[model samples]
Target: MADPKGFMTTPREEWPRRPVEERVRDWDEVYVPGALLPIISKQADRCMDCGIPFCHDVCPLGNLIPEWNDLVAREDWRAAADRLHATNNFPEFTGRLCPAPCEAGCVLAINQPAVTIKNVECAIADRAWEEGFTPPRPPDRLSGRTVAVIGSGPTGLAAAQQLTRAGHTVAVYERDDRVGGLLRYGIPSFKMEKRHLERRLEQMRAEGTRFRTSTRVGRDVAADELRTRYDAVVIATGATAWRELPVPGRELAGIHQAMEYLPLSNRVGEGDLVVSPLCAAGKHVVIVGGGDTGADCLGTAVRDGAASVTQLDIYAQPGADRDEDAEPWPTYPKIYRLSAAHEEARDLVTAPAADADARLFAASTLRFTGDGSGHVRSLHLVEVDAGRRPLPGTGRTLPADLVLLALGFSGPDRTDGLVDQLGLAMHARGTIARDAGFATNVPGVFAAGDAARGQSLIVWAIAEGRAVAAAVDRYLTGSSRLPAPISAYDRPMAV
Candidate 1:
């Protein structure tokens, strides 16, 4: 245990966000630089080191939480980093992007606040990089097997790193101009800078993971040819087919998909463009969705100097505290939360003190109205009850020059002809279907990540990647020693 009485003595604390006024002026990350390190040890000491740590089970990666917590509390940062990397290939990404289900499963959360596990993980990863503790570890000998992995997101990257370290020749192919899929473009720079991603890629390259960017399977290279060339193929293509807002005036000039708008802004950050073609400057922007994508749009719009930003959520506002009867302990619960982007939007001049909530919960978009010139002008909406039935006399309109649909994705896009050429079966929900071992219908072809599990968190993506790698290893050799964190059909604790 960390400090025998640490849980009772220390209070929970988190990384402080940069001031809204200062942060909104730049696209830098929202955190105050170097703020987490000083207090992270104390926060990590709060872990109880329970007899049965639910946090471990809740995490898809099955990270050694208590061990790392104890090491961090003892100021053994190098050992903490080793423990963190033992299960997770990219703690940096999960620390920045994951919603932290482990915290929800924390035993301490039964009464007091949970330990800052995510912050502690992020601190260790950053310190490891600063001290040059993160280095390439190439395989000792080649296994004489070749593997092809499509998509360079977290899943593909994790799998590639694992296979490379395990003595296999791995090649990751990405359709994008750069290696990273959403990590390079889907995510805005303000949330997580591109530099963090670049450094990791450098390490992967040194570890003998070949990256072939600007190459599209089933397009530039035939999918059948890839299968013939490699001993096995793993599909890590994420769920990118976005859901549509089927409403009137759908062809309005200013209305764009969240992926389309976000990528262009991210391109500007990558220095590929001086300005985004879908710039939100001086426009009234309306985002349809209350999830992280919408929050991302909110932050991007604010940085682009939008005149006003409004986010609409179809579901009712969640309560501040967990509903014990509805959602018991050891499960993730729906609770009202504020992101860094929401805080910046709250400080907007357009958001009044009385009703500063940028998110309008239980509000449904009826339709969009466009100007005579075909540009979006206003959005029609109405309040709805729990059943999603529109309430009477609740219809209203808000000015909207640019509208972004952050309604989330459907499944892996088959337009590339990869699924058609490979004859892979898809689940009823539209994701690629796989057996318990993460194998597709076709032999020697496997699926993992969002392509197989539907849109999910980065933690699950990494877990699926690691598990699928183990399965592929076993398929090649009679037996395998690689760790499989979770099965393909495994689900997270119900919320």
Candidate 2:
């Protein structure tokens, strides 16, 4: 265990972010570089290493939180990295992207600030890379079986890496020109730099995991062709069919789905374009959703020099503290939290709404008003109650030259034709149907990740990836040693 009495003596100090003024000027990550390593060990020592270790139980990856915390507290960086890598294939990604439900489940969090588990994980991962602890672990011998993984997102990457390390010849197909799906295109560099992803890709390539870019499984190459050539196929195509806001004037020239706007900015960062055509410079921007994607859009718009920005949330703002009655301890809770983007918005005065923060809680969009040229000029909205019913005498209009819909995704896009060609059974919710073993209706074909689970946290996607890989390995070899963290039927914790 970590320091026996450290929990009582130590107060939690999170990894510090770069000053708002400095970070907004460039596309680099928000956190201060080289600052985490110095403070991470002390934070790790704060872990009680509880008898129950609810932190580990709550993580979708089942990350060995206590083990790594103890390792870090002892300054055993190598062992901490090993323990971290045991369940998580991509700790660096999760460390940056995950919401850290584990922290919420920490025993210390019952009455005090939780240990900085996410920061510790990231420090271990980065130190491992710097110290040359993460080498490609190529299999000793080939099993002579081959697997084709469709998509190159977190799930597909995880499954391919696991199968490759298990001696199966694995090849990942990506429709995009680059191997990473959303990680390459959708995520902003300010949140996570691309260098981390590129380094991992290099490691995977060295480990014999092959990548096929710009290859659409059902279009460029038939899905059946892959099935005939490979012994098994796994679909990890993430849920990317974004939900639409069908209110009036949604078709206006200045309005776009969050996905459509985010990728263009990413492409600009990738040097594909000098400037994004959808750049929000000098425009009054209004985002229509309150989720992570909306926050992402908010950040991107701010960086693009939006004249003003406002985020509308259908649900009322949650309280500052978790409601013990509605959401008990150890379960993920809804509370008023300030994201880095929201902090930037508040700091820059980029959002001129009545609220101190850029977000308008319990706000419902009534309609969009457009200029005579057919570009959106303003948005009409009303205050809504818990039931989303409009409140009387609360209607208002705000200047909105650009409107982005970040309402989240419904399911994997079927336009790629993979689902139809493979005759995969789908749920009414638009996700692929899978059994406990993560197998689709077709023989030798399996589905996992957002394709089967709908949109969810990145940790869940990686967990599903690892689980599906184990199931595929079992199906191929009759018996397998790979660890499966969760079953197909597993769901996120709820009240």
Candidate 3:
């Protein structure tokens, strides 16, 4: 460890965020630039370097967290960056977007606060980029084999980059006009700026990974014909199919899925005048889910000048602190969180969170009301039990000019004819079915990420990509050298 007693001496300190009032007006990242470097060293020093680090166990990437934490504490930025990149292809993405399962699994989390592993990881990666230590690791010799990867999300990108570096010619296909899938489209600039995604894409392009955007495999390139052309294929289409509300008045004009609304804001951030049908400006916005996506909608609508915002959830509220009985130590917990979007919304709206209109865990949307013009104007809701069932005689109505179904995803988008053409089996939960090696029933094809693992964290997607890449490599070459950090067959810890 950098300092033996660092964990005992220093209390945990988080990266500083810009004052809520100041940050609410713009789309810049919430954190103050360069504020983390000052405290990251001390934060990393708090790592106990415990025997058999459970943080590693909890991470889907099995990232060398403790080792890098120690290196950061010692000011070995180069070494820390090297160790961090060993298991992860894009530490910056996980460093920013991941919820830090490692921190939850930290042995120290049994009592005191866990080490700021995610913050330190981001610091090391950022320092490496500044020092020009991150360069394309090109293969010494070409293998002369070609691989086609479907989707440009984290999984397909990871698999493509690894395969490209391993001497195979890899081409990544995306249905969107640009690459980075959700990273480019669904995520907002305030949480993490798009420059990070662009930089990584630049590195991947330089490393010899070919990209084909605005081209659907099943539609543009016939799935069967495309598979025949490539030596191997990997699917990472992700879970783009949004779950629906199936309630009365589901066909209102101003109502939309969160996927539809979030991406339009991202498009505007990309410096384009979006002709998108979904834009949240000067409207009474009612979001019907209370997860991360809901928070994202809250922030985007606030920046877009929504007249009012309200987020409704079917479940009861979580406690400010962890509930030991429901979630024991070394496991991820259900606790109250004040996300960056929530903080921004908190400042922009009225006094109490309820008055501010982002009410959580106590209500459910029953139906939408519309005028003769077919535009939504009000939303009817009823109080819900802890089980999310409606209670009698508590119905109420609120003006809602726009209704965003931030209810999250249901499963992969199988409408493109890829799954039907290939006849791949799906799990009972509706996610793609893959065996031990992430291989589908088809011989030369495999699946990973949300396409295979369902909607999940970027870290898990990257882990699945690396694991599936190893499997594909082994299948093609009859042997492989790629590292499979996590078993594709292994089940993750349940909430």
Per-prediction CA RMSD (Å): 1.2, 0.8, 1.6
Where does candidate 2 clash, by residue pair?
none
Top-lDDT candidate index: 2
Off by over 4 Å in 3: 274-277, 350-357
- Per-candidate TM-score against the hidden true structure: 0.98, 0.99, 0.97
Over all chains combined, what TM-score does candidate 3 have? 0.97
Q: In TM-score terms, which candidate is top?
A: 2
Q: Is candidate 1 or candidate 2 better by TM-score?
A: 2
True-vs-predicted CA distance for residue 235, candidate 2, Å: 0.5
lDDT of 3 at 234: 96
State residue 322's C-alpha deviation in candidate 1, in Å. 0.4
TM-score of 2: 0.99
What's the lDDT of the predicted structure labeled candidate 2? 0.93
Candidate 1 wrong stretches, greater than 4 Å: 349-356
Q: Comparing candidate 1 with candidate 3, which one achieves the higher TM-score?
A: 1
Task: Tell me the deviation in Å of residue 155 in model 1.
Answer: 0.6
